[model samples]
Target: MAADGTFSPVPTGEKSPEGAIGPRSNTGQKGGAGALIDYCTVVLPESSIEDHGVTWLPNLIGQLFGTNGAIVVGSIRNKPWQFYSQSAVLLDREGEMVGRVGLGGNGSTICVSLSGAGCRWVTRWDNVAKAVERWRGKLSRVDVAYDDYDGECLDVHALRERAAQGDFASGGRPPMHRFLSDEGHGTGCTLYVGAKGHKELCVYEKGKQLGLKTSPWVRAEVRMYGKHTALPLDVLTRPLDYLRGAYSVLQEIITGFCTRIRTTRKAVEATGTAMVEWMHRQVGPAINLLREAFGASWADFAEVHIAREGHPGRFRGVAKGDRLAQLMREELCPS
Candidate 1:
């Protein structure tokens, strides 16, 4: 979108002051005019539904009555609204439930579901409830309660700390008494989700060690735990993060000159004219995907950090007292 070709500082005076600010104009193409790409956005509570509507919302007025954004929007339409799972909670190494600021809906749910499914599938959570109960009893006999924590409210830094402690080798594994059915009897239960130790073959780096060990029950060496969690080896985050970061950086760099060329209408006109062309050449693929996959919600990913120009970070940060934190407590973690 073209920014209104004005770079005046927002006036602070209660009343309009004459010539309070200098005239500055920076113009670029007013509308996006480039090939579309598919992209996925990590939903955040603060993420604007209106912005997402641009790409996903059904068009009330149009010839086809729909566009690529609508189709892409439909893909993730059934995503759960809660940020955290009411039934499940994550624990860090210290055994103190990690605190986060967001809900466990969207990406977090997917990650948990996938992790649980990947680790234990055929067993099924519903069926496994009995097993979990049995295990809890065994562990309780040993004086342990099944630990619970949620991912939605934790900050990335906090998650990192917890992850470091949760690993089996790093002294992070939950107490045997907490997770096992019977430490002495070993008859009550075991960590059975569905299929135990299914390795996600999509992303595995043979050389780089992600720094964690896996269960002996795991068949193939390529497991998805430790560093291989959700982060893809080649791509980072959801793939959208890299593209968005690059786009934002490039946009900033290009717009930085807007101030210099504000007075030069010709330059403004030239840049505006080239904007579409530049975007097409550089970010067209990612943008198109973002629109297709996530629609206007792409903005939610705008602030996501990119470790490399091409890779996106898997985690989003939550500070101490953000609304997301409150939501996590109210919905996922009750005091």
Candidate 2:
């Protein structure tokens, strides 16, 4: 809404007109060192505008850039229309409002403009890469990867044969003991208890269809399909303690494995059941640890799943349960 009590429509699809305040500038980039100065001018449609809601933009900006770094400078209201400016005024960590983000247009179509100086000021003291990495870390699932062997790569059959001969842990590498094996898909899959007492499953598959003269390489991946927790950046940055917590949780799961798997099926069914049970037990304590570390805010965003009857069952983030179920199904039954 304009100051004169007239309703203005937000612009759609088109770029902000020249000389317009806070017009999108091409001089800035989205990430890296130049990210702070990068101006993003998006003319959203009615649907997008509604999706963002009135307060969402301000809140998001506040979260990304500290509250001191951004503020609502001015706002106007008319029937069914409201407008405000989110100025990136603070130029440094000291919290000084030295610049502004030009916000124009009205309810139907609005334009957000940023000056080159404003962009630079916004990014001057900001570590864009680290900030983005932190956000990504919050949204990412924790995965633990292990390298079974570092020497010459061996085919799945040869690897299994060597495992049968107890060759994997005889060297300086951590001693690994196999508890379950599955070859239902022609690929060799084995669950092992490492010397560190961590339980991991390795799937070895031979790549096919190389060039006429080239031999297909053997490929393998070690997976610890336990609890999937999207922890906050602060917790992730201090990984030593978090890892210790994880080790404790994994150790508990491994120690209780025998009691849980009293009755098992053939290779595939047995391995799947074990994996599912481990994941199920992994959720409670993992979520507790995350709640302790990141507080309740993370519960709203983190997706945790437990397995039921060899399939993924909801433990948290039920809104995304179906998607999580689909992903787990595909992973467990790749074919």
Cα misplacement distance, residue 49 of candidate 1 (Å): 4.9
Best by TM-score: 2
> Can you write out model 2's per-residue Cα lDDT over 1-335, one digit (the tens) per residue?
12232211122232222222121221222211101122222222334444545345554344443334433333332313225332233232223233333333444333333322233333222332244344332212222221122113334455555555655542345345553343343333444434221223343332221111122332232221212332333221221122222322221111110100111111223234445556568676776776787787656546443323433322221112354345446545769
lDDT per model vs. reference? 0.22, 0.31
Instruction: For residue 335, give model 2's deviation from the true position in Å.
Output: 31
- Model 1 stretches with alpha carbons more than 4 Å out: 1-42, 46-49, 52-216, 219-335
lDDT of 1 by residue, 91-137 (tens): 22222222111233543322112121111111122222232232221
Local distance difference test, candidate 2: 0.31
Model 1's TM-score against the true structure:
0.16
TM-score for each prediction?
Answer: 0.16, 0.21
Cα lDDT over the full model 1: 0.22
RMSD of each: 26.7, 24.9
lDDT of candidate 1 at residue 127, scale 0 to 100: 24
